[model samples]
Target: MTNELIQAQFGPRAMDYVRSSVYARGESLGALLARLQRDPIRLALDIATGGGHTALVLSPLAKRVVASDITGPMLRVARDWLAENGAENGLFCQHDAGLMPFPEGTFDVVTCRLAPHHFADVGAFLHSCVRVVRRGGCVAVIDNVTPPEPLAVRFINAFERLRDRSHNFEHSLPDWEAFFSTAGLRIEHRQQFRTPIDFGAYCDRMSVPERTRTRLRVMLLQAPAAARAALNPREVDGRMTFDLGELLIVGRRAAR
Candidate 1:
């Protein structure tokens, strides 16, 4: 049921994600690229490759990249986008992140960017990533994160769910650390950054109706002082904008 809902929500907006400035360019992407460049990657697996942006970025760094997504429509869009961009080393596959259809230790590097908050089972997904990545290889994750404060976490997650039904919940930094440990991956590097979201574009990308958008706007505006302060909503030239906290975590699979 969750997978069906996610596919339905994202299938039509595949191109929007491909062209989205937030996904196409970001410090997190740059950081991931730099980290990958430090070592040569024989083959990389990009799970939940929404628009093939991360695979495109990894194409030059890795000899081969498998861009996998669960949704057929999304995978098709990614394939088309990758072909159009001349990213020849990328291969598209329809696969679930939590249950990848690849042999263990098949990839030298694994990545999932800007997509895990929607994952139904992030721990299982990480375990699959660990299973597929060779020992001493890298697993990079870039996703929006919630604050440690219980109220702040609740508010941000509520806001996300209200805006997009596909959203699960944003995990905190500590949660990610624990997940990596449980997956037998050692966290080598971590960084936190903010991504500015244009409120209008955010709504339009999801094709949110005007009534729901209005309600969301009111909710944001009426949020408690603590929540509002954590969100840091701002209006510039009559356009609403806010920052979403994001995290980049690079871990290494431990050798036997």
Candidate 2:
């Protein structure tokens, strides 16, 4: 699906993902919520904010939350979600990850969870994150990544593209570090996070076709032993059960 087509895909399933424990309580949002609960925070910008999971968790802790996405329907659904959830501190706006419509140094904290890989330009996205955050403010990012091994990276990325056309590329650790450093954001914390996915639910989330899903399953099943070892495809009841990996990267904007 192109970005425009998938834009429609997200809002319709917004509630589905919001209610899904796999997504809401999964790796990225879970870590973000944990950090907020442990400390007082204010004035956050949740980039992408698909399903509003990150915004919902962080809104209550902040004085104000500006959750932005390129998709209008998505922002609408997120606005509705915040209203119903008693999170009056939050607000929504249309924004592209590669380019945002906000003034500089406006927010104390910024977050992009499980959504960066969809950006057609990752460097521009990170720099935009840096631009919005105030000096000494924190920026948190979360996304799936492949291991450094060449074969493993190619296989994982290719499978993801087959399953979800909107997927761009999952950056490696060095790529992230270099981007953040040059963007003037210091890496504050890094965690290799994992979230399990039953094969069917994962495919369905992206609305993958039956034929493509079958192809993905066969690819995983027949993967070279080394590749399979890295991906570790598993099954229960003779059906594909699990295969997913994620990462959480927390950074601090340079002190002015």
Best by lDDT: 1
lDDT of 1 by residue, 61-140 (tens): 98899999988888888888889988888888897789899999999999999889999889999999999999889999
For residues 72-94, write the lDDT of model 2, one tens digit per residue: 77787778878888899988888
Best by TM-score: 1
Where does candidate 2 clash, by residue pair? none
How close is each model in CA RMSD to the real structure? Answer: 1.2, 2.0
TM-scores of the models, in the order given? 0.97, 0.92
How does each model score on lDDT? 0.90, 0.79
* TM-score: model 1 vs. ground truth: 0.97
